[model samples]
Target: MSTSFSNLSELVTAVKAATDAILTTEPKEVKRIRTGGLPVGTNNQYFTTWDFVNGMIRDHSTCTWYSLLNTFEDERFSLDQCCALVHRFDYTFSNFLRYSGFQEMAVLAAALTKHLPTAKTREEAVKAVRTFLAYLNRLAAWLFHYFPWNIGKHLTYSYTTASIPTPADPDLSRRVHVADGRKVRLTWQPLGICVVATLATKENPELCEDVLRELPFSIIQDHAVVSGESMYAWAPVVSTAPVHVKERQCDAPVGRIRYSQATGNKIIVQYGRVTEDIETPILGEILLQYRDRLGEVGSAVWKSTFETKQIILLTIETVD
Candidate 1:
């Protein structure tokens, strides 16, 4: 476990594995830990670093990740570095540069491979894993901000009021912290939808639909509790990009946002209003998206406004 990773390829592999392991877990192993089956520690509460990592990799539950709350606190330096880089570069970074939609992940991975040197010690290796994980998360948030039309997190269902979007469903039990701190308890209820997009002509539209299958749509809800208070913000509105005509005689449209469908009504704009119980509180929006299956919510670049302040401009989609 102390071996140094020699090349950037190995580092990339580690980074990919770390990300792929985000929502994965093993319940049997976690049970073993909790029941004191492991020789190392009494239970998860007394878990060592290895035990903690195993629990996360195995069961990977919110409870397990909650255990990492202390890990992040203890490694505040690395956490801060990760946050600063995202805030300074990823979030506030210039839109002057961008990779094509499909190449986003590749470009993100490429950046780390630059300043990242091969690890010589276990500490260095641990730092690299944390830093790269942070980088992946930060990039994920930025993608939501930069590409609202093409990307948004999955929403289990649209909620117009303070009430939870989905009822007390156990399946919607997964939760994770978003990138932007706002220092709140941010939870994204990930949900997905599917739409069919094809370039076939009207005569062959059905054929094209059959050929390509329905495209995947992910819409994450910005519903969460911040600092022990129920906070809410309106879901972002996404509209079809303006279709412009190159020539006056040509009636075709141009400059419209791409993607034909969306989840909620654009005019209504009532996804995240506070519940009837409260009047005022700090809230966040700007949910995250992942390439995961529809029922699973992906990561995102969520936002929160402080005490009646304004919020960011973003949008989520619904199927046509």
Candidate 2:
């Protein structure tokens, strides 16, 4: 009969006791006994004891136990590395923002691109994809906040021929058939009027209307004049030409008055002499000439062209 026991000492003692009991009961039936050991072919075989002890030791040292410990340690270390990388990236980006003098939103954008996670290996590919998506969302928000001007929807309108009537001179009004066009009476505040007047001759010359086509005059009101009601004293139309006296006592006008249009909702008329040194005036002329291209002049056009050129140059340099 086979017997099983847990402790080594208990197993050895039980075997000895059973052997002794058998020997005493059947001394004559006992086979030749080996000194200091049980017989090779005893009831509990040599193979059984050796196999049981070895199996218990082997079971204790399983691959699953070591693998579990290793996996846990690796995860803890990876988390620490990830946190350190995130902190370092953030610090570097903040420094960049300070040096670059970028707005808060722009700083955030450039920072995220440099610091945002990316897949360097197949193992973390999924995580990289998720991080990239988050970066895109942040970029979109930054652009919207920083740049309010919509590049896609640009509008420009100009008046080719708009008529303005000279104040109630009954005889002149009858003689000169002033086109009774739709009157769009606009009230300009002190600052607004200054802005319009300055831009009329300076930054945007196209906004000025031709004196022959239309006459523009300012009106001061005791009470604010509503669009529908008309109660104001009109200012006189100023001449745009300089009266020049020739050596022979002859007078000649140098320039002519012209009414022009601008891109936005405003009217301007030139009331000054033209000169050779007029680069600023030339810029104004360009504005009038290309009235349809108002929003195209500044950062929008510059950024698009600059970025495209930079990308191409970078690609070429990299290839080289």
Over 4 Å off in model 1, which ranges? Answer: 1-4, 27-32, 42-115, 118-131, 134-226, 229-320
| Model 1 Cα lDDT, one tens digit per residue, 107-161 | 4434443434344443554454344543233233222222222212343347544
Q: Which stretches of candidate 2 lie over 4 Å from their true place?
A: 1-77, 98-320
All models: lDDT? 0.28, 0.24
Give the Cα error of residue 174 in candidate 1, in Å: 30
**Top lDDT hit:** 1
List the RMSD of every prediction in angstroms.
Answer: 19.3, 41.2
Model 2 earns a TM-score of 0.15
Across 229-250, the per-residue lDDT of candidate 2 in tens digits comes to 1111111211222212111101
Where does the lowest 10-residue lDDT sum fall in candidate 2? 311-320
The lDDT of model 1 is: 0.28
TM-score for candidate 1, please give it: 0.24
Give each model's clash number: 30, 12
